[model samples]
Target chain A: MKPPLWQSIGFYILVGVIVLQALFPFYYAILTSLEDGQALFEVNYLPRALNLANYQAMLSGGVFGKQILNSVFVATVVVILSLFLAVTAAYALSRIRFRGRGLLLLTVLSVSMFPQIAVLSGLFEVIRYFGLFNSLWSLVFSYMIFTLPFTVWVLTTFMRNLPIEIEEAAIMDGASSFTIIRRVFLPLMWPAMVTTGLLAFIHAWNEFLFALTFLSTDSQRTVPVAIALISGRSEFEIPWGNIMAASVIVTLPLVALVLVFQRKIVSGLTAGAVKG
Target chain B: MSKTVQKSRLSRSRTRSAWLFLAPMLLTLAIVAAWPLGRTIWFSFTDASLDLMGEARFVGFRNYLEYVAWGDGEGQYYGLLADARWWRSVWNTILFAVVSVSFETVFGLIIALVLNQQFRGRGLVRAAVLIPWAIPTIVSAKMWAWMLHDQFGIINDMLQTIGLIAEPIAWTASPDTAMVAVLMVDIWKTTPFMALLILAGLQMVPGDIYEAAKLDGVPPWRVFRKITLPLIMPAVLVAVVFRALDALRVFDIVYVLTPNTDATRTMSVFARENLFDYDKFAYGSAASTLLFLVIALITITFIMATRMDLEGKRS
Candidate 1:
C-alpha cells in the first residue's frame, strides 16, 4: 500500500527543504558569531575556530541590557493598554445594542490596516504635541492602532461565542448588563484576553518602523531598532561580531518564548490568521 | 433575588458600569486609531512636511496629483503608470506576493501532507518548521543577510564548492538578485505559517473522505485536485489574502536586507522614505493611503469571492 520511491523522495525533499531553509540562517548566524577573530574572514563552510569574544563584548557593552528593557517595557505597556481598551470596546459592542456597532467594528478593523506611513505625520504631530517623542511611550501608544482593533474584534468574537445562559442567569437575578459583563463575561473571556495580550505583546516587541522613526536617542531605542543600528554607526566599519551578538540577544527571548509556550503561541497566531 | 424590588438601583448601576467599561475603548478609538487615520486622509490633501509645518496649507489634491505615476517634483519626470517607479514597485510587489504565496502554498501543502502521515520524528519536524515563523523578522533578515554575504559567507562558498556558480553571488546587494533573495527569505520565514494555517484546515477535513477516495482507487493527484483543494479553498483563500495584504505593506525584512534599492524597494519602504527621509509628510500620506486602498480592494475582493463560494455551496 505504500507509494513508490518517488513519493518518499518527494516527501523527504519537501520536508528537508523546509527545515534546512529555516534553520540554516540561524545556524550560520551562530557560526559567524563564534568564528575566531583571526578566521572571521576565512571563507570556509564551517568556522575555523570558535570565539566567544563577540558575545563577551556584547554582554559587557550594556547596550543589549537597555534594548531588552526597552523591548519588555514597550511590549508590556502596549499589551496592557491594548487589552484594556479592546476589552471594553468588545464588551460594549457585544452586550449593548449600539446603533452603529457594525459600522464601528468595520471602521476600527479597516483603520487598523492602514499603512504606518499614513499615520506617520498625524502621529508625529500627536507625539510631538504631547512632547512624548523619542521615548518608548510614544511607540507604545502608536502601537495601540496596530494592536487594539484586532484585539477588540477578536475579543468580541470570543464573547459572542460564549454560552449565553450564564449572562441570562445573571440578568435574571436583576444584575445589569454592565454587572454581567464585569462578573460573568470578563472571567469567561480571560483565555481570549491572555491570547490577545500575548499577540499584542509579540507584535509590539517585533515592531521596528515606529521604533526607528520615533526613538532617536540611543538609550531609548527598542530591541529591533537597536539591533538594526548596532552593527555600524556613521563613518564606522560594519561590525559583524556586534551585529550577530545583538541579533542573538534580541532573538533569544522570542525563541525561548516559542519553546516554552509553543502550543499556546501557535494557537494564538493561527487563530489570528484564520479568523482574519 | 426576584426582579421587582431591588431592580431599581441595580439597573441604574448596571447602566453606569457599562458606560464605565466602554469609556476606555471609545476614548482610545477616538484618540488613537480613528482620529489618526481620519486626520491622515485630511492631511493628505494639505502641503505638510515634517520640518516645516508652519508652511502647511491646504493644497487640495496636489499630493494626489504628485502621485499620478510620475517622478517630477512638480508633476513627475513624465512617465506612464506602467513604467512609473512606484507603480513598478507595485507590480513587483504583486509578483512577489503571487509567486511567494503560490510556492509557499504548494510547498506547505506538501510538508503538511508529509507531517500528516504517521511518520517517525513528526513532532520534532513540526517544531523545527515552526521555529522560523517564531523568530523575529529583523533577526532572521540579518541572519540571512550575513549568510548571503559576498565574502566570508557559507551560501556562496557552498554553491561555488559544488560548482553551481563560478562567482560569488550578491544576494541582496545586486538589483537583479535582491527581490529574489527577499522572496527566498520570505518563503523561508512564512511557509511554516502557510503550513500551520493549512494544517488547521486539514484537521477540519474528515479522515473518512480520503478513506472513501482510497477505497474508490482514485489517483492521488485527482483526489487532491478535486477533494482536498476544493475542501480547503476557504482556508487557502484566507491565508493567501492575509499574505497578500501583508506582502503589499512589507517593510522590515526588506528594510533590513536591502538598503532601499529601487529594484527591491516596496511601497511601504517608499512611503517611509517620503514621510521620514524626505520629510514630505503629505506626499507620504498619499502614497500610504493608496497602499491602504490597494489592500482594501484586495480584501474586498477576497471577501466577495468567499461569499460567492458560500452562496454557491448553499444553492
Candidate 2:
C-alpha cells in the first residue's frame, strides 16, 4: 500500500534534516572562510564579504608547510614499507603451508588491537633511546602498529581469494617464488593492494596523539596537531576564519579520494572490523 | 631416477621459497610489533617510571591485583580498587563507546537507506556527506569546535534564529555539555563511514526479492521488515560491531575537541595522561592492558557470534 501524503512529507523532512545536519559544518566553514577580515564573528548565517585572506594566511603559517610535509612523508613511507612486507607475507600465509601462519596472524591481530596509549610509555622510551623522538621517522615507525596488521590481514584475505591454479601455472613455467610474486601475482593483486594502501595511508595521515606527543616544535608538527593547537596571540580569542580555511584545504584531498574510490575504500576499511 | 631426483629437488626448493617469502614479514613483526607488545605487557607489571626508567622493579600481578577486589587485602596492595579515577575512567569509556556507537549506527542506517535509492544527483550527495569522514579527526574536531563556540558560533546563531534555545551554551567548557559535544563531533565525523559500510551491505542484497514482495501486494513497511531486514541483518550486524569497536577506541576526537576534564576523558585519554603527564608508566601500561583486553574480548565475542568462516566467505 502507498503511504499517505503526510507520511511522505514527514519522511522527506526527516531526511532533509539529516542531510542538512551532515552538510552544515562544511557549509558554515566555507562561508566563514570566504568572508572578509573580522566578518566571521559578525555574521553567522552566511558570508558578508568575499575574500581569500584567511586561506592565504593559513597557507603562510610557518607550521602549515612543515606539518603538511610531515603528514605526507609519514603516510607515504608507512604505505610503501607496510605494503612491501605485507604483499610477500600475505603470499606466504595464503599460498604456502607454513607451520606458524596461524600464530603469526594471531600475533598481528593481537598487536593491532593494542591501544597506542598502552604502548606509548614504552614506545616513548624506545623512541627516545633510539634518538628518533621528535623526528617524522618515529611517527612513521609508530604508525606500523596501526597499519601493518590490517595490511597483512586484508591482503591475505584478498590473496586467498585469487585462483590457486594461476600460481601453479607460474610454478610450472620454472618461475622462482619471488619472481612469480613480483611479475605474475602482483599485477593481479594491484586493486587489493591499492585498497589496503589507501586505508593505511589515511590511518597514518590522521594519526594525532603520537604526532602531538612526539613532536614539540612547529617544525616537526603534523597537520592534525598543528590544526588542533593553533592559538591566537591573546587568551580571549581563536582564529576561526583561518582554522576553517585550513580544515577545508586539508580535507579536500581525502574527500576527493574517498569519492573517487568509494567501493574500494568502504570494503578495505570495514574488512577487518566486520570479520573481527 | 631422474624424475625422482627432480621431484626431491622441487620439494627442497619449495621449502626454501616458503621460508624466503616468510622471512621479511616475520622479522618485522617480531621486532616491530611482537617485541614491543611483549615489552608493554612486561612493563605493566613492573614499577617503572618514564623518567626513572633505569630504576625499574618487577612487581608481578600487582597491576592486575589493583583492579581485582575481594575480601582479601587486594585493595591495599593493588590500589586500583582504592582509586576511584580508574573505575570512573572505565565507566566513562564504556559510556562514550555505547552512546556514540548506538547513535552512529542508527544515523548511519538512515543515511544508507537514503543513498540506496535510485535518484538524481545521488553520487554527488553521497560523496558530499563523506567530507567529514575524509577530514583528519583533529581538523574535523577543530572545525566543529569553532562551529559550537558559545558566543560567535553558527550553531548558536542558527539555534537562536530558530528559537530552539533561550541562551548560548558553553559547549566544550562546561562539564555538562563537554561529553555531549565530543560525542556530537565524533558522530559527525564517523557517521558517513558507517553509512558507506552499511550502504555496501545494502547493495549486496538482491532487489528481486523486494520486487517479488511488491507483486505479492506487500506493503512498503512489511517489505522492509521481512525482506530487507533479514537479508541485510548479517552485514548490518557486522558493520555495527565494527563501529562499536572503533568507538571504544576513540581518543583523537575527544582529546582534540575538549579539555581533559574528568567527565570527558575516555580511558585511553586517562591512560595517556598517566603515562606522559604523570610519569606513571606502569599505571598507564595497566590501563592500556585493560583497554586491549576489552577490545580483544569484543573481537572474540563478535567472531563467535558471527561464526565467520573467512576462508569460505570469499566475497
Candidate 3:
C-alpha cells in the first residue's frame, strides 16, 4: 500500500510549495521590517541583521500606539455586544418553532451578504445625525450590520444541535425559558460563543471602509486604516519599514489566535458555511 | 383537558419569548441595516450632494441616466449608465470576481487534496496555509505592495535573479499589471479559506469508500474525478459563490494596492469615490444601488437555483 518513491517525492515537493507560498509573504514582511536604509533598498534573501529600530520607531510614535489601542477597543466592544445580542436571538431562532422562522433566518443571511458600500451614504447620514462621526461609537454601531448576522446564524446552528432532553426537563421543573437558557445552555455554548466572538472580533478589527470613511482623525483611526494612511512627506519617501513593522505587530496576535484555536475556528467556519 | 391546557400554555409562552428574544436583534437590524438600506435606495433618486443633503430635491433617475437634448437631434447622455468609467468599473468588478474565485477554487482544491493526505506535521502545514487567511486584508495588501514594489521590492529582485524578466515591472502602478497584482494577493489570501471549506467537505467523505476503491484497483485520478470531486462539489460550489459575492465587493485590496487607477477601480471603490471625493453623493448612491441589485439578483437566483433548505428540513 506504500506509494512509489517518485510519487512520494512529488507529493512532498507539492507540500513544500504550498507551505512556502503560504508563509513566505509574511516572513518577507518580517524580514523587511527588521531592515532599514541601504539594507532595505537591497533585497537580501536571508536576515542579515537583527534590528529593532523600525519596531522602536513604530512604538515610539504616539499615534501608532494609540491607533493599536483604538483597534483593540473597537474590536473588543464589537465582539462583546454582538455576542450578547446574537446569543439571545439565536436561542429564539433555534429553540423556538415559530412562524416566519425560515424567512427570518434567510433575512439574516442576506443581511450578512450586503455590500457595505450600499449602506455607506445612509449610514453616514445616520452617524452624522447621532453626532458620532469622529467617535469610535460610529464604528461600533455600523459594524453590527456585518457582525450580527453571522454570529446569529452560526450560534443558531450551534444552539439547535443541543439536546432537547435537558431543556424539556427544565421546562417540566417549571423553570422559565430564560432560566433554562442561563443554567442549561450557557455552559454548553461556550465553545461556539468563543469561536463566533473571535470571528466577530477579527471582522471588526480588519474592517477598513467604514473605519476609513467615518473616522477622519488620526488618533481615532483603527490599525487597518492607520497602517493604510502611514506615509512620509512625499511619495518617494513612503515609509516601507515602519509600514511593515506596523503590519507585523497587528498580524501577530491574529496569527497566534488562529494557530491556538485552529480546530475551533475550522469548525466554526464550516458550521457557518457548509451547514447552510 | 388539564394536560392539553398546560401544553397550550407552554406553547404560548415559548412563542412569546421567541418574539421577546428576537426584539432587540430586530431593532438593531432595523436601525443599522434596514433603515440605512432604504435610505440609500431612496437617495439614489435624489439630487443629494454631500454638503447640501438637507436641501436636496428629488430628481428621479437623473443620477442613473439623464439625456440632454441638443440642436439637430444631437445629444449626450449623462449619469452612471452613460459614464464609461462606471461601466469600466463594473467590468473590472466582474472580471476580478470571476478570475479570483476561479483561481482560488482550483488552488484551494489542490491544497485541500494535498492536506488530506496522511502526513507528518499536517497540523503545522494546515496552520501555515492559514497564515495568509489570518492576516488582515489591509496588511496583506500592504505586504504585497511592498514586495511588488517597482524598484526596491524583493519580488522584482528575485524575478530578475531568477531571470524571469529583463527589468522589474511596476506592479501596482502600471495599468497592465495592477489587476494581476490584486488578483495574486487575493488568491494568496483567500485560497486558504476555500481550501479549509473544501477540507471540511473532504473529511466528510468516509475513508472506507476510498479503501474500497483502492481494493478495486481504481486509479487515484479516476477515484478523484468520479468520487471525490462529485462528493465535494456542493461544498466547493457554496464556497465559490460566497467568495464570488465577496470578490464583487472587493474594496480594501484594490483601494490599497492600486489607488485612483482606472485599471483596478471596482464598483465599491467607484461608489465611494463619488460619495465622498467627487461630491456626487446621489450619483454614488445610484452606483451602490446598482451594485446591491446585482448582488441581490445573484443571491436570489442562487438560493432559488439551489433551493436551499432555509427551514432546515434536510437537517
C-alpha lDDT of all candidate models, in order: 0.76, 0.80, 0.93
Question: Which model scores highest in lDDT?
Answer: 3
Q: Candidate 1, which segments miss by more than 4 Å at Cα?
A: A1-13, A43-50, A176-179, A233-236, B1-20, B66-83, B304-315
Q: List the residue pairs that clash in candidate 3.
A: none
Query: Which model, 2 or 3, shows the larger TM-score?
Result: 3
Better of 1 and 3 by lDDT: 3
- Those runs of model 3 whose alpha carbons end farther than 4 Å from true positions after fitting are none
Per-residue lDDT of model 3, residues B153-229, tens digit only: 88899889989998999999999999999999999999999999999999999999999999999999999999999
Ranking by TM-score: 3, 2, 1
* lDDT for A179 (candidate 2): 89
- Which candidate model has the greater DockQ, 1 or 3? 3
User: Residue B153 lDDT in model 2?
Assistant: 75
Highest DockQ scorer: 3
TM-score of 1: 0.89
Candidate 2 lDDT, tens digit per residue, B1-315? 999999778877876787787788777666556666667778888998877775778988776564545768653445444457888878878888888888988888889888888656677777677777877888878878888888887778778889999899989888899989998998888898888878777888888987898788988888889878788777778777777777777789888788678788888887888877888888787787778778879888866676665443345
True contacts kept of 3: 0.81
